[model samples]
Target: MLKKGLYGIYKGVEFRITVDMDNNLKIMTDKKEKTDSTFEDTYQSGVYTKIVKPNELVDCVSVTPFGIIKGEKVQILQEKENKYQVATGALLVGSNLNLPRIDRDSWLGWVSKGEVKLFEEITPINPEDL
Candidate 1:
């Protein structure tokens, strides 16, 4: 199924990104817990992610419209029906690169792992186990 949100569907898909040891890393998230307005919870994770597409880069009548997401950049490398490659650009919201971070909020994705394409739900699901 395709996704529903504030971004675009395209000849290619969009991706959020991060770098570790100067290499691209995929974003991964795990909801730690629900709070009762008193305590805090956290999780240790090694996965990374970024969100792309489904956006037009401008808005009005919305405050924090890009809440969690501050900005987006896309480079169209080669876009086919199932494959998308691109050059890169991203920015910190409020121009605060000193403490820049990418937000993960139900962003759909497509990446080639070996000769296969992958999404978070697919790579982690057990079609047989279900």
Candidate 2:
């Protein structure tokens, strides 16, 4: 299985893999929960959200590296209370190259839930289609 923060093919579908750090390599996917569910009740595995607030600058938990602005995409790695652990970077799935070093340009840190909105619902690609 692909390690956390790495992008790879799983069951013929491309996914930016993440795992529950507290769990034993439990792979996280881009599946979202039903509408009625609350944040705590929702499965936050590989959920991806995009910055929606215009001109907004999201601050990292620790030292501020750079600004995360509108329309930037981030994957939800984990959720705690009102904040989410998100990763922002480019997708390397269909590049046709060996998996490069994890997240050369990625940013991983906590962001408030209000900074982002649900981008899309990811569905695994059909194996036969490949």
Candidate 3:
């Protein structure tokens, strides 16, 4: 079980679970702030705060550079070294953990609409490495 600020993968995406000074649990996703309505709405739609185990709400997964489309999993190779291709929900690393970037693109669109069972283990990653 993790305490306070930590990052975990939820449904193939990364999320930061934070405990405020007041002890209120806050689940944060990439690009969405606590104050964002989309964030609040997504948070409200799930249950994780009551669980004692971090895995109960999230998991750790490898950085999947490829994803499936239609029926085949395609690799998301960058057209150039260190180039950004705008992947929605692509697990990104930087100043903070980032979720895959979702947009109107067909590939990204497929990822955003996909679902994983609550607490389902996708890819287990160490918190420190996150």
Clashing pairs in 2: none
Rank order (by lDDT, best first): 3, 2, 1
What's each prediction's TM-score? Answer: 0.16, 0.32, 0.25
Give the lDDT of residue 41 in candidate 2: 22
Runs of candidate 1 with Cα error greater than 4 angstroms are 1-71, 89-130
C-alpha root-mean-square deviation, candidate 3: 14.0
Tens-digit lDDT track of model 2 for 41-129: 23454454221221121121111122232556455666678766666565542122122335666556666767646443334322222
Give the clash count for model 1: 10
> Candidate 1 residues 1-130, lDDT tens each?
2221222212233322223354523222222232122222223352223322223221211111111222332222233465433222333321332222234312222223222232222122111121
Model 3 Cα lDDT, one tens digit per residue, 1-130: 2112355655555566665576654556445322333344436654333212444455644443443334333344333333323233333321122334345333332123232111212355554332
What is the number of backbone collisions in each predicted candidate, taken in the order shown?
10, 0, 10
What's the lDDT for all of these models? Answer: 0.26, 0.39, 0.39
Q: Under the 3 Å rule for N, CA and C atoms, how many clashes does model 2 have? A: 0
Evaluated against the true structure, the overall lDDT of model 3 is: 0.39
Structure candidate 1, residue pairs in collision: 6-54, 7-54, 7-55, 8-54, 16-50, 16-51, 17-50, 26-48, 27-48, 27-49
